[model samples]
Target: MSPQTCTEGFAYDRRARQCIDVDECRTLPDACRGDMRCVNQNGGYLCIPRTYSDTSCILGYTLAEDGTCNDIDECETNSHHCNPTQVCINTAGGYTCSCTEGYWLIGGQCQDIDECRYGYCQQLCANVPGSYSCSCNPGFILNPDSRTCLDVNECEDEPCSHRCFNTYGSFMCNCDEGFELAADGTSCIDLDECSFSEFLCQHRCVNAPGSFSCICPPGYYVYEDGRSCEDINECDTGNNTCTTAQVCFNFQGGYTCLDPLQCHSPYIEVSDNQCMCSAENPACRDKPFTILYRHMDLSSGRSVPADIFQMQATTRYPGAFYIFQIKSGNEGREFYMRQTSNVSATLILARPIKGPREVVLDLEMVTVNNVINFRGSSIIRLTIFVSEHPF
Candidate 1:
């Protein structure tokens, strides 16, 4: 026959033949609240942190969806231990525990042991009337015999964040060359070594994830020391676009292409920067007497519709109309000339160009003489060097 009432943790079944353990974990869901996983015992339920459960997933990180070591949102999936009454707070790798530390249980209860009063702990000691136990320091665990303490080797777990070194009782965290260990000693952040010194880069310093880069201006290059800038001699390095008819002159931060003071195609050198067509040759009567060469540098992926180069009439005359056009070498139609004024024209890039490449264009400017029946024209060979990288 069944008793009238069962014990505190035992519930009488329908038949009432025998008493069964009550599942307090299910019936009293609030029994284990706040990051406490409820484990059903024979007579009661024990609350434990999910991070310290028997199936702790920290060793392999979390059970990611792609079967990789990625963080799994327990709160989002309703897999957290927080009960309905408490708010679920998610941590980096796991959740904090609301449950108290569990005790080591033996087969049966016993009276106070006399040896415990003497104390046998490597770190702390506590003595009470009917109970006493030996405990180790924070970085140690009690041995099976309950009298010995063993040091905890934390480095074996992982990179405390990036790298770890286990010491006698605790561990130290170290980061790589380009990173620095955070204050928490379990995480790492990028180190901006460039900020330490302005001399680190001659012109500009670009900070990156794990490193930095020093950049120089267009007419210069980074020195071997990776900190200073040196002028690049475009004339000697053949970096200039000057044709055989022109000469390249290098300067501090730029280079210029100048006329060689020699005439070509029925033209004669007249002055320092001018030439004259032979009046005797009918074929040369309409040909241009002056030719010029120019070069420009641009970074890759430049925004289109940007003005690249401008040409202005150095010598203006009255009753003259100026017209500018791209004669040849603009096969891709990547550029067009916009006349800003009667005496000035601007070369506009029609589309963005990806480098490293060179674009050569033959531009012509004709001046119609309305007062006199004479028309003169000039051609400019322009070379645009697009850099492989954007500064």
Candidate 2:
């Protein structure tokens, strides 16, 4: 078959079945630069420089090669064309990057590691994104062996002289030669053994501060240290130790014997403390009596005459009588009294006046009226005493 040719200005061969693409720029060698790429299409081949192709152009440039991106090199135009934390890498059709160590790759970027926020371990453990740590257990210390933890033995050495107490991770020793523990458990010192002695008959004994003893006279059995001497129970002591009048009460280092009738509640305590009395021992009795007092007021506009009189009421107790009598005075008044069989007494005034009236009563009751006003501003006074027997 012969080379096929197009119509119009170019000649055509009737016998040829294929048509070859014709190079439009056969004369030019470097037809496309680094920024441009050439592509071939139907009818007539099209030449699009890489600068015009979207796949070869810079990130901000548009596509010119029929909108088809054949390849892309992100690192060329922007260096780190994506995120600063990512490594810019070029690909055949696109560009991408990833975060490096110490940073986690997220959506399209890198994030910091929040080691302290997670509560990483018990006791104490420091966390560093890609690393972590642990702590020593209680009663133990961090051991360099295998870089782990180990226990400490407190009782390994003899720390106390009298008593040895071993606690977790530690131990203590105490002394027994009349010595007691000091404030600290690891040491001991002499105790005051002589202060508690009760016996008054001791002649001589080496009195250690923490203990003491009584030395008895001849013919007397000596009691143990710090205790008083009592006749030893001869029946058990292999000697006749008790007297016929005494009963024995034995205690540490000593004993006591006394006659049964001689024992009594000591009354000495009564003289030292206050005397307490109750209903069973009444201290005093209450007196039977009644209290008496009267209240009175003068009318604002009423005045009593120079001399006026009126009768007043009275009050009586079951076993007593009270009486009121009007006395003579413009301001001062007096009460009169008389004994009667009736519990109550009444007195009538000898003089009477229609104007304001001045009156005084010796009992608790009073009778008032609008016409009985006082011509002079004055108050009525009542004075009375109770008599138990009425005659």
Task: Write one digit per residue (lDDT tens) for candidate 2, span 55-76.
Answer: 4543323355686544444478
Q: Could you say which candidate leads in TM-score? A: 1
What does the lDDT read for residue 308 in candidate 2? 22
| lDDT for position 208 in model 2 | 59
Off by over 4 Å in 2: 1-122, 126-139, 143-150, 157-164, 169-178, 196-391
lDDT (tens digit, per residue) of candidate 1 on 1-391: 2233555665655452234566777799488879988766545667889777745544314665654555556677777765443344444444321211121112222223344545555566665544456788887988887777899998888857688888888999988888998888889899997898987886889998779999997878999999777778899999889898887866555566766666675777666555667657897776775667666777677888899899888888889989999988888888999999989999999888887777889889998897897688887878777765543
The lowest-lDDT stretch of 10 consecutive residues in candidate 1 is 97-106
User: How much lDDT does each candidate structure score?
Assistant: 0.71, 0.40
**Residue 182 miss distance in model 2 (angstroms):** 2.0
RMSD of each: 28.0, 32.1
Estimated TM-score for each candidate: 0.45, 0.27
Task: List the candidate 1 regions with Cα displacement exceeding 4 Å.
Answer: 1-172, 176-220, 223-231, 234-262, 271-275, 388-391
